[model samples]
Target: MKSLSILITTVTFYLISSMYSYAQQTTDQIKDQQFTEAKETIIQDEREALKVEVEEINNRLQNGSISKTEADTLKNKAAEKHAKNIENRLIILKNTLELADRNGDQEKESKTGIYVGWDEDANDFVIKTSVKRKKEKKEVYDFRTKTGVYLTWGLLDLVDDDNSYGNTDVSVGRSTSFEVGISQTTRVFKKSNFLRIKYGLGFEWNKLTPRDNTYLVDNNGINTMEQFPSELRKSEVRFTNIVIPVYFELGPSKKIESQNYIRFSTQKQFKIGFGGYGGLNIETMQKLKYREDGRKVKQKIKRDYNTTDFVYGVGAYVGYGSFSLFAKYELSPLFENQPIDKNLLSLGFRLDFD
Candidate 1:
């Protein structure tokens, strides 16, 4: 009986020793797995740091603050270091995880599973990530309206025959005029440079001089005859007229580049239009010099002596940038009872606006 008890005690001690050794082995395996996981985390953090450094270098290059040589050197170093670190970390992680798996330790396997769960959670975090910001769009305008004023100088040409006034030997001289005007423009058709409308008001001055000794014969049924010299007839004749003009203009569409309170430059560079004009003579004054006035004395004539007539013309405009120029010819006689209808021609420059 004493021998059996001693044997039983020895057996119990050996079993306890074996159980403690197994427990210690499990703890060590768990510790090693945790250490490996920590090393992997440090490797991943170093890679992210390298990526940040590379991005910083690229940003510096874009900002023109870094030299090309320095940027290239830094980029190469970062790439090489990142590659080497990744290769080394991958080898270490593979070998360590393989050894932990071969060991068949439950604690190490559990730790590795937990780390995989953490990795899955990180992947989910990345998948759920988003950026929040307000998006904006650019604004644009289609059509624009503009206004302007201009000064013009031109010649007045009359197409009507002066001989109808019964002065066969009379000659009509060129009638020159000065004009000042204001204009307005509106965009009409937009695409294909199709159309626009321009309207304007202007004042005109005309001067006319007769070139012959015309005669007017008066005969009575009682055989009485009378002859009047051209100078005498003209002495009673007046020659100046003022006009007010209004016109409707149309042309190709254009874009405006620069503008002031009163002027603008446009992209629509060419224009063609036709309009009518009429004016009231606020003041028409004329002076007559005759042979009887061989002493060169001048006589003042009234506005009513010569008839005030309407003036009109057709014209075209062409230009680019801030400057625009136009040329037009008058379509009607500037004076009434004249031997010839002298037409007017004009050239003008205008400043445009919107």
Candidate 2:
């Protein structure tokens, strides 16, 4: 009876030891698998975050908001993150190889997944997995009118030696003029938006101040400059016009593409344009501000003054950036049926804004 009890106790002890060892081994296997899965998940999440960051940096570069050097720095950081991602993947492979060696699992060694290795040229790790990406579709925009506003202030003068407005009495310095305009630009070519036709409406004011105390006078449908009576401080002839201008503008342009639209980029360098304009005179006036009878006085007279009711001109511009050199010469005479035939000319610069 004693031998039987002892034998039963030893059997129970051996079974308990075997069961405990099996449970512990199972728990260890579960832990290792969970650890590997958690690591893979972390690596994947990190790689996705790096991809998002890299895209943002690339956007800044294309938008011209960041310098090339800054972009390169960001790109290097992204590469480093990519290298780290590869390293994490390789670590899983290395652990699998070791686990296979300890367990004597030849199949795991033979059929291992995701072969990752070092790439010396790239200074990073390379994955042997191949992934195919879908090609990006391009979105094109319909032709539309692009508009801009410009402000111009420049010198105004009369051209032609015979029509020099009564022998340089019209001081060029005092003939400063101003113009404001709105322009609509249309692309002339579908493939190349660099060539464009621009047409717009503008308001111009030209002031011609005469020297030697001279002022303009109208007599019998004729315009002439006469000496101002009394000690005149200043005298000027002013004309206002509403003009329509057409131009063939040419320049180098870049395409700016968004997700849903594409358009030509704005370029401010090395632009050339030739155009013509026609307009109607809105107002013509002469002003004389002088001291009479030892008192301050002013005279403003509005008149036909034989000035041309309609005017047309050809002009050209060459520019770098917003500042441009511009020249315009009128085809029509300054006055209609005048005693002297004169033509208007102007040279100036314009500041453009979108």
Candidate 3:
């Protein structure tokens, strides 16, 4: 009876031990499954975070606002994170395969596939794709036009054989006079290689100073006339002319492709053109004399040298953005049948627009 009881007790103890071992194995398997799921979750989260970071960094780069160093740093950080995430996924995959092998479960082992980490090359590939897209979207323009106002000063030369009173005179001066005027220019045509026209009106002012001298006889000595000097005499002549100028321009069409403070953006902004002009010039002259009381007397010899006629010229203009410099030589004389011959030559600067 004692032997039988001992046998039964041993059998019960063996069954309990076997049952406990089976339960512990089952628990371990469950833990492994949970760990694998958790690892996969962590890897997926990491990949998603990496994708967000990459997008943010790419946006900053495209915006062109960040410094070069900052962009490079962000790129390196993203690359490192990508490598780490790949490594973690690869480790989890290897462990999963090893766990399946240890359990000798053919089905689970067959199901366990290797996790290839996020492709390192893919980040660079995406960046390159974005860069190519941006490059394809750049734009370019062909032609442009602008205009503005201008002021000029030039020397006027007179060439005639007439005096202040329209009389034949070796007594009058034939020196070049000074002139000044203002105008506006507008561009009419523009092309890659083409011609342009600019038209504007100007007003010119001129003055001529004569040279001739006469002497007066006195009891004590010869005295120079106060108004007309004994050695040198001079007459003052003034003229005002209204002029119109047309400029023919030629050059590259893409001169003003870029935006700038100057009206145009081309070195070839300088142009040479023929100009036709028509206007009225009012001319007057004055003579001076000395009185016995030591006072000077002034007389107007010619007040209405007013003439309406055509004035034309050939000129050249050079421009730097909105600023321009010009020179012109008149083809016709200021007056017809005058005592003196006069031709107009002028130099001046102007502001232009389009």
| lDDT per residue as tens, model 1, 62-99 | 79999878987886676557555655554444445445
TM-score, each model? 0.39, 0.59, 0.40
Report the alpha-carbon TM-score of model 3 versus the true structure: 0.40
User: Lowest lDDT 10-mer window, candidate 1?
Assistant: 216-225
Please give the lDDT score at residue 345 for candidate 2.
Answer: 77
Q: Quick one: best TM-score, which candidate?
A: 2
Error of 3 at 267 (Å): 7.0
Cα-lDDT of candidate 3: 0.48
User: In terms of TM-score, how similar is model 1 to the real structure?
Assistant: 0.39
Highest lDDT scorer = 2
Q: What is the C-alpha local distance difference test score of each model?
A: 0.48, 0.71, 0.48
Summarize candidate 2's per-residue lDDT along 1-354 as a digit string, tens digits: 353245334433443343343334434533455434444454555555656676787789889999989986876666566555545454554454445345443223235344444344643333454344446667768565788998678777765665463356678877977889998888888767778887889998988887788888777777777887777887988999899989898888777777977788656557888999999998999888899778999889998777788989998898876678888778888789965577777888977775
Q: Residue 99 deviation, candidate 3, in Å?
A: 64
By TM-score rank, best first, the candidates go 2, 3, 1
lDDT string for model 3 (127-234, tens) is 111111222433454334444455555443433333322232222234333333444443454323346666666676655454344322122332112335332334
